[model samples]
Target: MTSADARDAGDAEAFPTVQLDLPVPTNVRVRTAEFVKSSVEISQCPKEGPPEFAVIGRSNVGKSSLINMLTGRKALAQVSKEPGKTQCINHFIINDSWYLVDMPGYGYAKRSKDQRREFDAFTKAYFKQRGTLAMVLLLVDGSIPPQPADLDYAAWLASAGVPFSIVFTKADKKKKGGPRALSNVAAFKRALLEARGFPLVPPSVVTSAATGDGKSELLAFVASLRGMWEAAKKRR
Candidate 1:
């Protein structure tokens, strides 16, 4: 196996990527955002209901802040200064129609061996078993190049045939022309492209909780996927 392969599955396309790059992205009209519950296991998750879009990433990727910005709520999701502060599957009911899941940070969080094992077991189960899982918003640090933890986990998603999109966070910390973030995004796409099983780049959105940039695009993407998910359910 090559370096990229060993680092990630880079396998062939097992499933078609979702077309989320809509020509005209729609703005998300969030009417209500409410905290529901937190679960540490898949069995404890709420009964199958509305489509769920899970937000996941490494520690300190500003997942909470992003969630707040997206929902137009100041503190719907708890924001923590310490990495890995969240260690449960947090569910937020949005617009009283769908769910926004705040997943625990995977990599770069200091945890005991047992804690890491628990995360690996339950998180993967949630991804594989959750019936209402629509799309996972995979968060990555826009300030730096792709980290191995991010790439490897992305590779796992590809191998598992899970539906997800790349979300570059903290877009406000960039240069005049945003060279650093641009370069980092480019590098991440390139890495995924080179992976064996991975197909073309998945949909990507750059967002900044501070400046509220790319919020519309991200919402539009979510709206598009939500529509698709709903249609699929109807067909079933």
Candidate 2:
């Protein structure tokens, strides 16, 4: 076990597990969701308007599963067995308030060089030009160790000055009462710290679509950011 694992084990032993039922606020609850549009290029996306939260990750990181789980709707975002199925910027309006943007996944080996370049251009433009983007939820597979693509993307986001948070998905796959996921998360954090040479790493959350874990937390976070976004808009 790594030092991070040792620390995690100690912390787990020190703390007692508690379940709290907290009421979700009105803004956070997904009363209604509808598919808005799909855009192959960033220029084709909706004009600067509502605050947008983007969901992105490497291919097959369970992004669609997490999105559907958070919204409490089945089949909201199409889940496909095939990797790199999402080829466009798919938008879904939540409660007719904010936009949930699903971006194309990166680092698919089967994609041709030209296809990868096209996607790279699309994603880069979206990230660079999307002025109304509030935050990006970068999903990572929690069952495995830190991936180079994930780490590199995190660094790129930081350098681009894009606001994002890490969402570790597939937590349910980890062994019950085991620290594999936590250890992996810790290792990722350490890697980030080493790369950035700063103790401050992007905020991260663990999630499990199968058990609906972290759904409320994720919604609550979005709600908080939405409140700030609305307030900022009003001020402007």
- Model 1, 71-173: lDDT tens per residue? 9898889898888877899999988988999988886547887887788778778988887899888999877777888898888887887788889998777
User: Relative to the true structure, how large is the alpha-carbon lDDT of every model?
Assistant: 0.79, 0.80
Q: Count the backbone clashes (under 3 Å) in each candidate.
A: 6, 0
TM-score for each of the candidates: 0.85, 0.86
Error of 1 at 97 (Å): 0.6
Score candidate 2 by lDDT. 0.80
Please report the candidate that would top lDDT against the real structure. Answer: 2
| Candidate 2 per-residue lDDT over residues 12-112, each given as its tens digit | 44432222233344476888888888999777898888899999999899888887887788998888889998889999888888988988899999999
Best candidate, TM-score? 2
Worst 10 residues of 1 by lDDT: 5-14
**In model 2, which regions exceed 4 Å deviation?**
1-26, 175-182
